[model samples]
Every structure is written in C-alpha cells, then in structure tokens.
Target: MLYPTLRPIRGATLLLTAGLLAACALPRVGPNKSEIFAGSVLREGDAFVLTVDDRVNAIAAVAPALGFSAGFLNAGELGADTIRAGDTLGLTIFENVDDGLLVPTGANATAIEEVQVDAQGFIFVPYAGRVRAEGNSPEALRRVITERLAEQTPDPQVAINRLAGDGATVSVQGAVTAQGVYPIERPTRSLIPMLAAAGGVAVEPDIARVTIQRGDQRAEVFYDDLFASAANDIALRDGDAIVVKSDSRTFTALGATGAQDRITFESRTISAIEALAQVGGLSSTAADPTGVFVFRNEPEEIAEQLVGQDVTGPQRVVYVLDLTRPNGMFMARDFAIRDGDTVYVTEAPFVQFNKTIAALTGSLSAANGVQDATGL
Candidate 1:
C-alpha cells in the first residue's frame, strides 16, 4: 500500500512537470518578434527586415501615380460646335425671288427641322443633293449647302443649326448617381463635368476611382485627384467608356491587433498610423509596442532603394516599427501602408512568461488534488 501511494504521487508530479514544459508552445495568433527577426536575411531568414527611419520612410512612401498619361493630358478639348455622324441638323433655305428651288412658290423661305445625318456622314436636301456633314461645323455645313443650292436658285440663303448627336458620346456607368449614355456636350465635354452630368459619383470621394477606356487606351485616377489637379480632368472622347467605382485596394490586419481582418483603403493614400487607427489600434494588454511590423512584397527597384542592394522582381520585405522610440509614432505616421500588406503586432514578452507560469500553477494544483484522493 505504501509503494502504491508513492507511485501515484510520482505519477502526479511527472504529469504536472510535463504540462509546464508544454506551456511554452501555446497557440498564438502569429510568430513572435524573435521568430520573425530570426527568419530575416540578416539572420539567415527568408525576408529583408529594415527599421523605419527618415530615409526608409521616404523610400517606402512611394505610391503608384494615379492620373492620365501624356495622351489624355495633352489631348485638346473637343469642339462643341463640331457635327458628327448620327447628329441632327436643322436647315432653313430662303430665296429673294419667287418659285425658288428649295423654297416653295410664294413661301420665300423653307424650314426643315430634324434632318438626321446618316451613318455615312451625309445629309440630303431637295436640290442640294447629298452633302458630307460629319467633322464640319454648323457654319461650315451652312456654307456648303448655300453654295450647292445657289446653282438652282440665285443667292440662296442657308442656315444650319447643330443638335445633340448619337455619335461622339460616352457611356457612363458604375457607382454614379445616374448611369446612362450621355452626349459629350459643351457642359459635359470633360471628365469632371461629365461625372457631374451623371449626378456625380455615388460613393465617397476619398475612395472613388474613375477609369476611362477609349479604344485601346485606358487610364485611371482618384476622384479627388480630378479636383486636386486640372490635368486629371482629362478630355472625353467618342465611344469612351467611363466607370466610377469604390477603390478595391485592401490590407490585412492580424496578430495582437484590436481587430483582425481585411481593411479597405479609406483614401487614395493611407499611412501606417491611419491604418492602425482604422483597425481600432493595437491591443493594449497583449501587444508589443516595439514589435509592430509591416510585411510587403517590394518591387525590385524599390527593394534596391530600401536595402541598398541589387534585387530583381518582387522581394519579400519586413518593415519594423518601434513605438517606444521618440520618433516611432511619427515614423509610423509617415510610413505608407500599401495594398495587400500585412500589419502584425507581436505579443509582449511577459505575456508568454505569464502564460507559462499560469499553466504550471494550475497543473500543480490539480496534481495536489489527485495526490490527496489517491492517498488511500
């Protein structure tokens, strides 16, 4: 009976000790600071880890330019008076003498409204025959008609007025107040005006993006950028397809954060501090203020600038942000968090120690109870 009692106590002690040993391997949201740094290139790790300094901040602050190219910026504004195919024209012909070719007898003047231009860009008049109207101004078309009718009637007077055409139009759709095909008129000749004509964008201006596709050319810009710079208010073209939509850019927040999820970019550009704030900031009790990290895939050119080494294509990069330093918060504020980035905060070192101690103490207490029960 004594041997059996001692054996039970020994068994209980072994079980408690094993439970304490296993406490170091507790489940965690992600790898800790030491594990992350150990994997960096400096420590024979897979990624390049760099501290966020002024130079690094400036280098990482680079964002993709969002605006039209030379083609869109350099394009001349469309002439509102110019007539295109499928447009409607109003024509009036007058002759001083009676029995004029175009004007009926005793009428003196003949007015024809809604004279639609055919697909071939031609408009037909009774005696004037077919006349090319596309690419011609209203005044120019009037001159062409007056000269043609003069052959049949002496000093024929012609007046031509241009109307909204089916051609030279753009299709506006997606996230606009109104989505429809709108003619490029005097008031809606450019990007911003056309958007206004569509009742403006339906989404927030900070996250709105406008993309214009004309044949083979395509360009995109932030909705706010259209007002920030005049050059972004690009000229509209015939058959142009304009789409306004909310930005699709997002980043993942994980590890000791107040919230762990994918967060959208509220603005065209979001700094690290802003991103942290968006996710409800870091966990007050569990987060290591010195272990905030941003993981990203840097382009070769940017990676070279960041690491002072020659790298090609996409490079795995980890940017360390220490909030304990005096400039740490400013560094975080200045650091740019890009799309598809992962923001992770490691746990405080004492958190693991506490977890281990708690596990050991709980197991020891359970073992003592087991020993007492088996003391028969």
Candidate 2:
C-alpha cells in the first residue's frame, strides 16, 4: 500500500513542477507600444529634460487669446474678465461735486452696491434704468450710463463705475480638501487659484483623472503636467465644473520585490524607473536583471492600430528591459507610465523551488488528513 501511494505522490509532484515552470516562462503583456513610446520620449523639438528653458519655450508656443499671447504676459489673467449670467457686478455713480473742478471724494455723495447681471447682460441700475453691460468694457458701460442719464437731467453729470457684481460660479466635486461651488470672475481664471480656493487637493487626489467640463467639451488634466509643465495648467471659464476623482485602484508588485504592494503615482507621466523606486527599489535576492515586466491594460482599438505599424499595441506591449544594460536605463526613463501600470520583478529560478516546496507541504497535509479519515 505504501509503495502505491508513493508512486502516485511522485507523479503528482512532477506534474505540479512542470506546470509551475511553464507558468513561470509565460511572457507578460504590457502597455501598447505606441502609447508607451509616445509618452516615453519627448518630441524631437520638445525638451526631455524638464527645465526652465523648456517651460519658457512651452509658454511661447501657446496661442494668444483675449489680447494676450501667453500666460507669462497675461496680467489680467483672472476669472473676473469673463462675465456670465448670474454674475453680480457692482456699479457706482456719483454726482458731480464742486462743479466738476475737483476730484469727488467718497464723502461727497453717492450710492454703491452689488447688482446681479441677468442672462441677457442687463444690469438694473437704480434711477438710471436697465443697462446692457455685457460685451462692453468698464469705460464703455460708464459712457452708456452717462448717456442714459442725460434724458432725466440737463447737464446731469454721470459717473459710470463697475461695482462688484456676482461672478460666474462653478462646482468642484471629488477628492479635494473641500468640494463646492467656486465663483470665478472671468473665463481666464487660472485653475490653480480655484483649486486652492477649494482647499487644494486631498492627500491622494487622483491627479491623473482630473476632469474639467464646460458645456459639452471635457478635458483631462493630469497632475504631473499641471505641476511640472505650466502650459498644461488651463484657465477656467464660467460654468466650468472640475471633478478630482480619488484613485481606488492600486498596482501590486510581487515575487522578491522590495515592496509587494505599492500605490501608483497619480500623475500619468511617471516613468518606469520612477515607479520602481517608489516601491523601495528592486529586491536583490529575487530581482532578475533581464526579467523586469510592466503589465498594463490595453484597449482593443489601440492594439489594432499598432498591429500593422512598427509600433506595438498602445495598451499592452510588454517591454523587456535589461537593467544590466546602460541603454536600458535611459529607455526606462523614456517609458512613460500610464494610470494603472503594474511593475513586476520576477524572482530568480531558485525562488520557484521555494514555492514548489510550500505547495508540496500543503498537498502532504491534505493527504495525511485523508489517510486519518480512512484509518489507514
């Protein structure tokens, strides 16, 4: 009876060992080659080494808008300039005191208060009646008010001034210190200030997934770009809703790695080397110099686009990087990591024996249990 049991156990052990070896030899499916390469290396003209010069050039390349060529030159780059419906504008009119000879002091006489601008850009002024202030400059609105007042008083002096009015309001929801509606003064309002106003982002805000919605257009703003490249920090407009989501998913690096479980960087631009360092670097015992694998999701459409081309799939293209090679280190820097990239460092072949032994011990335990039950 012992001989028969030993033969069967030996066969089972051999089969398990073969299965484990086959599993170990299987290749990992990584990110799409196109997407990885596109992000890994900077464009020919673009700067790979992020520096002040790169920032300056990036700013210069931005298109001019609203009489401003770039963010560096824009002084009135605030939200107040872009007026929208429901925004309150303050208007102040003063009577010509001292026969218009002297500058009228605040004490002379006047009325000042906040007034709401209607959707049609109409602001109801006291005594002066409704005035269309939208699309008009501050001076233009003042002149319009003075002209309207001429109908009521002869030689009636009018002073048109923009009083503080309601500014455009936007809602910021998700992974922020505070999530609520923020009032923006104009369309050119910088997003940084708004995020600051909302109490900044949470400790682990989903930086890669920041979404900005305005009307029908939606833009994804990654944290790394927002912080690293000033050009990517977009201006906010009225009625814009910014949502900062929290990252619930995490990447697991197992098998003789420095850290078994590590949270992925919220920024989409992190490199493969940076990711490895984040988990306390590679394990000396199990890290194979040529067996580093980065597993990531690949969309079918993006994969198909790379099939015929020189590029690999945009979603899943396993990059076999040799740490021993100096060129490979540079390539690691070029490989831009995506949102859910999993960096796995396979153990040396000897590690497989440890796993196999553990499995055999469990099998023997089960066998003993069966023998005891049968009173063998």
Evaluated with lDDT, which candidate comes out highest?
1
Query: What is each predicted model's overall lDDT from 0 to 1?
Result: 0.87, 0.57
The worst-scoring run of ten residues by lDDT in candidate 2 lies at 45-54
lDDT per residue (tens digit) for residues 108-225 in model 1: 8989999999899999998889999887778888999988888877998998876556547899999998999987778888999999999999999999999999899999988888
- lDDT tens digits by residue: candidate 2, 1-376: 6655554554465566557655664332232223344543343321121211223223322221112124322324443554555556655554544433222554444554566678898887665688886655556667777677666544445444445544556788887888988766543267777888888778554343467776876666454446656655666655778887754445656544677776755453466677787787777765665566665544544334333334343444444555667566766666655556567666665555665666657666666676567665
Q: What shift in Å separates residue 105 of candidate 1 from its native position after superposition?
A: 5.3
Position 228, candidate 2: lDDT: 59
In order of listing, the candidates' clash counts read 2, 23
lDDT of 2 at 236: 65
